[model samples]
Target chain A: MSQTVELKVDLGERSYPIYIGENLIGDTGAYLNKHGFKTGSPILIVTDETIAPYYLDTVVNSLRSAGYTVVTHIVPAGEQTKSLSMLEAIVTTALTGNLDRNSAVIALGGGVIGDLAGFVAATYMRGIRFIQIPTTILAHDSSVGGKVAVNHKLAKNIIGAFHQPDYVLYDVTTLRTLSPREVRSGLAEMVKHGLIWDEAFVDWLEESASKLLNLDLDALKYGIHQGCRIKSVVVAEDERENDLRAILNLGHTIGHALEAVAGYGELLHGEAIAIGMVGASLLAQKLGYSSDIYTRTKALLQKFELPVSLPKHYDVDAIMEAMSHDKKFKEGKMVFVIPTAIGKVEINRNVPAEWVRETVEQLKGEA
Target chain B: MSQTVELKVDLGERSYPIYIGENLIGDTGAYLNKHGFKTGSPILIVTDETIAPYYLDTVVNSLRSAGYTVVTHIVPAGEQTKSLSMLEAIVTTALTGNLDRNSAVIALGGGVIGDLAGFVAATYMRGIRFIQIPTTILAHDSSVGGKVAVNHKLAKNIIGAFHQPDYVLYDVTTLRTLSPREVRSGLAEMVKHGLIWDEAFVDWLEESASKLLNLDLDALKYGIHQGCRIKSVVVAEDERENDLRAILNLGHTIGHALEAVAGYGELLHGEAIAIGMVGASLLAQKLGYSSDIYTRTKALLQKFELPVSLPKHYDVDAIMEAMSHDKKFKEGKMVFVIPTAIGKVEINRNVPAEWVRETVEQLKGEA
Candidate 1:
């Protein structure tokens, strides 16, 4: 048995644990028991086509061995699949499968599947219990915080709810199957965790970059463990993004706009966010909130081979239009989570649109 | 100004006040301020075409006078509009209106709008604040409990969440515009509240049956007040329907089946529930859980001119199939909220299909 680290997201009645370890999926029964999931309850395992072939059977077999009835729902893999149609299909499958409120939905893939399945569980029969079984490194961030949604043509994650999961069962062994780009994309968020909340962790990640990129078991475990710990604390303090939780969107304001401009799936979520982090830092430095941090963040992102500037094809006008539609905008003003220092950020809703345009222009020139 | 009754549905932080009175819609600004809704926040008012012509401007003007940016989204009226497509349209409208996380969605119509708009609010930007503005007597019941959803071809309310609203602003004056059939439909749920929770309230309802059906303001106010009080207590004690809340569904098991068979608009929701109450009472009588209460219940329903028998067109096999698909089923056994007395009920999950079939056959004979 590989070492396990258990962290509880303290949400009072909705609080649940995040269990991170290597090869935890092999001992699924033990984790289910430890978390007090009743054996033999019907389970719906929701995954994407890309993820099902590798680990679906392993999970189904374990649950079946424990006398639980398991049903598998396979959605086509990709960001484009996250829509209202997919949500309806999943709900239809759950109803057709005769799954009831007592039955649990297991999100057994990456962020897309976790989001789709989590929303299904959140609304099926006015909400049912669901557990997250993350399969990719990117999921280390998405799997926690209970913010699940599908994208709209106008906005990503515009239609969703804040539904916490029963527990998150993350097995780092699954990260072995990730492609190199996937590995790098996942690291962006882990680095974000460091930049927004922990300077020491950022330095540690800088030193351990190669091990993390190479998927060393201990390095991967530690990265995900620290990322989830930071996220759990933030979510516990502000489950709804009413205050402290908004800081978690450090790179997201610009990142989400870039993704929308790139037409989703063209740019991986973490890749867009990586550029977003750089844009936010540049704006922060220009605003005199910080000096040198923008260069420092750019260097860190470069070390991980993540994009440190906006893509040349994305014009400032298009990016600004997309950002204007972001849900974070308040009272007709765009809200940007700006990094003021290493491990410190501020939600500045008063950022002038011209400043953002100018920063994007400069970033484009550098690119 | 008509007499007002203020009741609170307490779910800790999720608790909200239900303001019941006549002409309350005219004082919309006062209510919004009382609820701490900041002026100048964007508001999306979701109403149906039928309601928009009647009261939309009044509400929009009130908020606009207070410097709030109000956007009105008018859906077509009726049961057929309660669909995933309609939900998609509403969400799209909210997105197009540039409504953000700080925005509020006001459900400004009857039960269908409440469920649809509430689901939109419940999921829009991962749940935003929403207030229920119920315009029909039937909405008095649907608006309070925060059970919001749209219909699927396979099931009604199959896709939804238990998202409590910030407040329920029910102006009984709106009920004055309802047709007699609409009045009858709304009364069914109120009668169910009396049948399942309070025997004295049932007696009072029976005495005031004519007044309620004729839309007497005081009778309508008292009936809705008592119904909400009962529902509030039940929801407070069991918000998720783990046990006690199931009793609130006394007539809904077979009632939902009848509505499904009747094809949504063929029979109004309350008419179906009225028939469902009779079906359940007959089943209760067959199971020896009650004596003449079934007869007493049928007489009371008839007094309000509510349907007391399943449609003659419905067959036992078809209704059974529909009930089997209900979300209430657990482990292949059907759950029924069977009334054992005028003001008492039990969640009987072990009811034999044979007993239900016989009762439906008898109900058809009576029809």
Candidate 2:
């Protein structure tokens, strides 16, 4: 028997159901049919060069067996590949392929392909339904969240729209191919869900970190399902991150800065987030929130073999400046997510900026 | 005393309040204060070479006296200025200007500046709050709508986000300097609002077309207020345009095609939309909606001196291809906004592609 995860993204009727399971890839045909996904339509599959040969054939074969006309667009792999040049190249091919509004794009690969293809779906004749078949572990968080965007050289996820996929097929099988680092990066989010919203989930991570590290299938399924659930509910409540959804940034504030300061792809997102979660925890403890929760969060992160501190040589001022540019800061104060309790997170902006500076200095001394 | 027209966009908490009055420009400071727009924060004013030279200092003076720190960025002006290169340049400046996430951008110009600056605010630090202080008739519609995006050569508004302004100040006095052509483009949206969801507003446009053309402040305010109301209602319901908001594309389907096919900036947006609206109305009539509605909509458009048909020289295939690439067509078939009834709309993908071809042929014949 398969289990269904309910994501309550709060876009009213725009809300959708996300089904996670082992053989979702083989069964997507029915989900497609059930959701009014046009049958026998010419479908353009936008994927990365790295992910296509491995998975495109499966999706294409499934789509073909289901009686659909499939046209595949294979883009070069890498985050750098998500550019105007790439978008135009695919759009030109899509245009040449007689692709129109009725044609759907299956974004194969991780976040980049999802965003690039989703943008293509969004602006191509206004919008189209695209299904996300995320292949990377890092995508476990990004793929389901309705925040589809591509990066500019100056910023990440800079140009995008709030485009929800018609459906998301987690296909835990895809994670089997992820590198060890990818698995670790994705684990940060599972831990993030625990620290920010779910206590039991946190304890679950603390116990199952070994199973996840070993790529245990059931553990992977539980982690992904629960992480998606946390995000889905927040998204269901605040699809645009205007309110409670912003809490999902439990570790993303400093996590993104670490990635940016370290130069993107330098620090694994999950690794940075693991460190960020510690920083947020320490900040929470600094502001006198919960010392026990902070210590436990760090201990759990350590158990996963994730780094909970920055490299010794990284510039503190640059990190601080990068954080100042973080999207969470509002009204001239840097907003930090601090745990009020294990299951409760509060968006804290009133905490003195000097304390953040002090933490940076303290961390520098410890380094 | 001046009357204020309110645009109640239903984006839950992220929704902003729009104030349309005779002197919204002067009231910018007071309104921002009243609406919880943080005081003593860094403000970046985005303007263009054209409008900035005229009123930038005045806006700056107002903010400075209100005890706010204001920084100004001036771009060359016009639709051509709304590009990726320009966005990069401004971001560099914003970063150098030491813009933190707490800072706000005040977009102080027409649609181009509003879209460009709004996108900057949307992208900067993953997103930031920016206020809209529009200086053109066209901006009355755009400034009120939360559809902030930038143009890529592949698609107009291809890259963007649905980030609303903290507040919108639509100063009617600013419209006096706009070219007759600019004012005409602004009316396309007012016309779209009536065609999509506002039957009484359609009657109002019919009754007050001359007043709009004559630059009657009362009629213009009425038009903007009603347009904002319709847009706000749709946006509030579907901020990301997953459903009800798609109705806003009544004429834009063909209008965007006309703009792209004719070459952007060749035909003003409103002019293309006017022609597109004519084509859409004609298509709607042919699809068995109502010939009476078509005549009435066309006559009302004609009264505004909006272009009623496309030029004979434009190839139908070119426009069709442009529409194919329209950010509206979802999968493969072109979706049309056929009148379920005047002021009521149902997105009709059931309309054949043949109807689009036939309509274009008829339009060419009329030309």
Give residue B348's error in model 2 in angstroms: 9.3
What is the lDDT of every predicted structure here? 0.85, 0.78
* Residue A204 Cα positional deviation in candidate 2, in Å, after optimal superposition: 4.6
lDDT accuracy of residue B266 in candidate 2: 80
Q: How large an RMSD does model 2 have?
A: 5.6
Query: Backbone clash tally for model 1?
Result: 0
- Interface RMSD for all numbered candidates: 0.9, 3.9
Candidate number of the best lDDT: 1
- The digit string of per-residue lDDT tens for model 1 on B250-354 reads 888888788777764688889989988998888888788756888899999999998787667677788888887675555656688888889888889888777
Q: Between which residue pairs do clashes occur in model 1? A: none
Worst 10 residues of 1 chain A by lDDT: A325-334
Candidate 1 per-residue lDDT, tens place, A1-367, comes to 5688888889999999888887777666566666676765678999988888899988888887776777889999987788888888888888777787778899999998889898888888888888999999889898889999998877777788888999999998898889999999999999999999999999998899899899999998899999999988998898887899888888888887787778546788789889889988888887797668888899888889898776577778888888876645555556788898988888888887778888778878655
Least accurate stretch of 10 residues (summed lDDT) in model 2 chain A?
A: A2-11
lDDT of 2 by residue, A1-367 (tens): 6665544444666766666667677665666777787774577889887887677788878887887777888888888877656766777666667675677888888888988898777655446678888887677788766776666666666655667887777788777878888888878888888778888898788899999999887888888888888877777777666778778888777777778789656798789888878778778888887689777877888888888777788898888888877654565567888888886899887767777777666554432
Model 2 vs. true fold: TM: 0.76
What value does DockQ give for candidate 2? 0.19
